[model samples]
Target: MLELEGIETGYGETRVVHGLDLTVREGTVHALLGRNGVGKSTTLKSVIGQLPVTVGTVRLAGQQISGRLPHDIARLGVAYVPETRDIFGALTVRENLELAGRLAGPGADWTVDRIVAFFPNLAERLNNGGHELSGGEQQMLAVGRALMASPRILMLDEPTEGLAPIIIQQIFGKLKELKASGLTILLVEQNLNFALGLADDISLMGRGQIVWRGDAAALKADDQAHARWLGV
Candidate 1:
């Protein structure tokens, strides 16, 4: 459902992702795994139009999305949840979600009620400010807010970052539910087991390019691939 072809991106003069090609199919969870500084996040930024694709094009479904403005890309059914989980701290949880809900086009199926149902913990916290929630709660709010936009593909960068084990499991469980419901996801995650459990396809990135691509079972058995590409 999403494709990046020969994309090169960087910060100013410093190059990060170089000629990286990857694709996420419809209704599947594709995990992009890599150690720090491998440009996993950069790839997502490029897709979301937060960073320019210095070389190749990004396509959603079939149309080329390269060089479009961020908001335009978002309106075309791409929702990004950054590693920082950038929820509006001053806004109540309801307000935060409603802000994104306003961006939904006609026939949108995601509403505050649906989001609350999807995230049961959020139901009671709607009146609470973003800052009032714990780290896990904030992350839930971030994902829920993104869903409010009624996106076709949801990209999450390090959804497990900075959370306790229990919370991480909760997040993973919710992601599995989303996957079962056929919401396409492109995930960049550091947690090895978490990624393996959820992704239908796995791509291991090294130095700004995809070095290995395989399914979870193949990766799980290939200890050499794990050690060489993943440092496992």
Candidate 2:
């Protein structure tokens, strides 16, 4: 239940996203697919208030959120997992989750223990410093921190980036389970196979605009569409 209409954004004078539009339905995963420098992340930043919309509007369940502060937007049920693992290097894994929980306030869907349960490895390393964890573990910690906020919609940017294949599978599996449990997700991904495999709907973007949008499964049957729009 998020919508972006005619969104135009950029860093300073160099515009990166132009006239972007998309809708994310509740209880489903909507993917934003594009190559590098195509404004996929910029679009997300615009929606989440990291980058203000130069034009157009962003709405959640129909109310406008375009101009709200980043923290306010987050408080309104949008959780972001950035491409960079934004974990505190010196903080304990548990402490990170706790801080996230406190920042999001109470009444979150997932508790600290619930997050620990979902990530058992993190549970064992609860007191360990963030720097001590492996890359996969760090990724898990990032997701766990976001989950602690108990968001209504989760926007993940390259959740599988740099992870081993097995770890990626584990992460995707968990994401699928979350979708099954009614979590609406907006995913920004470059791994075509990975995005198509899990996305309910996929939109291919180029140069800051959506070039194609369709059911994820349909892309496989239409090689021409894939070749022309996705460059795959």
Candidate 3:
């Protein structure tokens, strides 16, 4: 559902992502794994139109979206949840979901009730401000907000970073459920076990390029690749 060919993008003149090529099939979870500075996040930003692609083509569902504006790309059924978990600190939980749903229009599949059902903790804290929630709660809120867009492809950067193990498990479970529901996902993750457990396909990046690509089981068995690039 998503493909990036010869992707070369970076901040200003320094190219961080060098001739990267990737493909995420429909209704599957594809994980991008790499150490710090391998351009995993930059690749995602380039695809989502946050970072400029100096040389490449980004296609979503066979439509070119390389140089489009971020909002315009989002309108084409692409939802990006950055590592920062960008939520409105001043907005109450209910208000945040309401605003996202309103922006998504009436045909969105994700509703406030459904989001709450997926995240029962959010249901009880509907009136709480975003700032009032814990780190895990905030991450849940971020994912919930992205789902509110009713996206065909969900891109997440470091969703499990700094969360408790229990919360991470919960997040993984929700992602599994989303995958089961035929949601295509592109995930940039540092956690090896987490990525290996949930991803159908895995790609390892090094020096802004994809060094290895394989199924999850193949990656699990390739200890040399894991140690060389991922330091695992």
Candidate 4:
């Protein structure tokens, strides 16, 4: 379980997220949907300690974590997979995964072998550098690396961005499996169809805060909300 209350954060003094409040219940996938620049990524960054929350509290399982360091937040079982897929380009696929596990300092349920198996495509790419992987493979590596930390809640930003349709389907399937395994996920995605397929609950963000909240069927039926808030 994770909660953000009245969060205000941004780059320098230029605020992007304004009074944003969101919550992810245990063992559920909650999708944060929005157009570009609605602060979906910023909210994730703020929760992970990449950006400081100026006004409001971020709580994970009822423990306040807004002011903590990124590594510290990670140690508390919060893992983040940014849209950039920030893997170490110089390191081999195995090295990239092993490094995260090593930094996590034991007790991680995910191991290098486990990650490789989870992303079967990575099994043969073990000795290849991160730079050598395709976009899909890189995305898988990014998710796999995050899993190495044995996170309680995983936050992903734009996981389906700029990928082939087939690759997106693969990602969707993997996420489905993750959800079935009871891993809590907070997803910031622009792909409405993808989000609807995986999320149990969906929240729409406009400007910088939530404008609508509902399940997939409810979202589909809300033409007014879509037209007004989503410009559909």
Candidate 5:
């Protein structure tokens, strides 16, 4: 479980996020959705300690982690897959997975073989450099690398960005499977349909604040909520 309250953060005093509050329960997918520049990514950065919170607190399973180092927060069972997919271009797929596992220490759930099994395409490209993979393959590698950390909670920013529709479906399928296996996901997504299909709850952000929050299905059915907050 993760909880954030009244979080204020910015890039060097030019505040981008203002008083944002969010909650993600254990074993559930929580979607944070908003238009561009509304601070979805900034909120995640604050939560993961990539950026310092100017106010309020971030707690994971009741342990405060707001200002901790990103590595420390990661060691506390939080894994982040940024929008850029952050893979090492020169590293082989196997090497990348191994590095992630080593960084996570022992007791990681996703072994290299297991990650390959989950992503058979990755197994096929084991010897290939990250730069040689297609966007979909790169995205899979990103997810696999994060899984190597064996996190209880995974935070993904735009996991489906720039992928083919079929690949997007595949990624969502994998996300569904992870959810069924008891992984708590905090997703910052632009694809509302994909997110709504998987999320247990939805929190819609506007102007760097949560203007709407509710059950995913209910919000999906509420035209007024969509019009007012999502503008779609």
Candidate 6:
């Protein structure tokens, strides 16, 4: 569902991602794993149109999406939940979801009611301000808001960062449900077990390029690649 070929992008004069090539198949969870400073996030930024692709191509569903505006790319059915977990601090939980649904427009399968059902904890805190929620609730709100867009492909960067193990399990459970419902996912994760447990396919990145690509079982069994590139 998503493809990047020879993707090269960086901040300012220093190039971080070098000739990165990767693909995420439809209805599958593709995990991009690497140690810090290897440009995993940069590759995601390039695909989502936040970073300029100086070289190579990005395609979604067989159409060229490279160089498109971020919102334009989003309208093409890509939903990105950055590591920042950016949500309006002052808005009520219900209000945030409302705004997201409005932005997503009509005819989307993800309605406020549907999302509230998917996230029942969010339903209980409908009137609470975003700032009043706990870390886990905030993360759930972020994912819930993204789903309000009814996106075909969900791209997450460090979705489990800084959360407790219980919270991580909850988030992963939601993700598993989403995957079961046939949504494609591209995840950049640091937790080896989390990625290995959930990912259908895995790609190890090193020095800004994909060094190995295989199924999750293969990645689990490849001790050399894990030690060399992932430092696991």
- Model 6, 1-232: lDDT tens digits are 9999998999978888888999899999999999998998888888889999998999999999999998888888888888998888899998988887764756898987898899888988999999999988998999998899888899999999999999999899999999999999999999888888889999989998999999888977888987899874
Tens-digit lDDT track of model 4 for 68-184: 999999999899999999999999999999888865756668999888778899999999999999999999999999999889999999999999999999999999999999999
The clash numbers for all candidates, in the given order, read: 0, 0, 0, 0, 0, 0
lDDT of 3 by residue, 1-232 (tens): 9999998999999999989999999999999999898899899989889899989899999999999998888878888889999899999998888877654756789999999999998998899999999999999999999889898899999999999999999999999999999999999998888888889999999999999999888987898998999894
Worst 10 residues of 3 by lDDT: 98-107
Q: How do the residues 93-182 of candidate 1 rate in per-residue lDDT, one tens digit apiece? A: 999999998878988989999999988989999999999999999999999999999999999999999999999999999999999999
Winning candidate number (TM-score) = 1
lDDT of each: 0.94, 0.88, 0.91, 0.92, 0.92, 0.89
TM-score of each: 0.98, 0.97, 0.97, 0.97, 0.97, 0.96
User: Least lDDT summed over 10 consecutive residues: which range in candidate 2?
Assistant: 102-111
lDDT of 4 at 165: 98
Prediction 6 global C-alpha lDDT: 0.89
TM-score of 1: 0.98
Worst 10 residues of 5 by lDDT: 100-109
Model 2 per-residue lDDT at 64: 92
- Write one digit per residue (lDDT tens) for candidate 5, span 148-227: 99998999999999999999999999999999999999999988889999999899999889998898878968998788
- Candidate 3 at residue 139, lDDT? 93
Q: Tell me which of candidates 1 and 4 scores higher on lDDT.
A: 1
RMSD of 5: 1.0
How far does residue 102 in candidate 2 sit from its true spot (Å)? 1.9
Query: Which is better, 4 or 6, measured by lDDT?
Result: 4
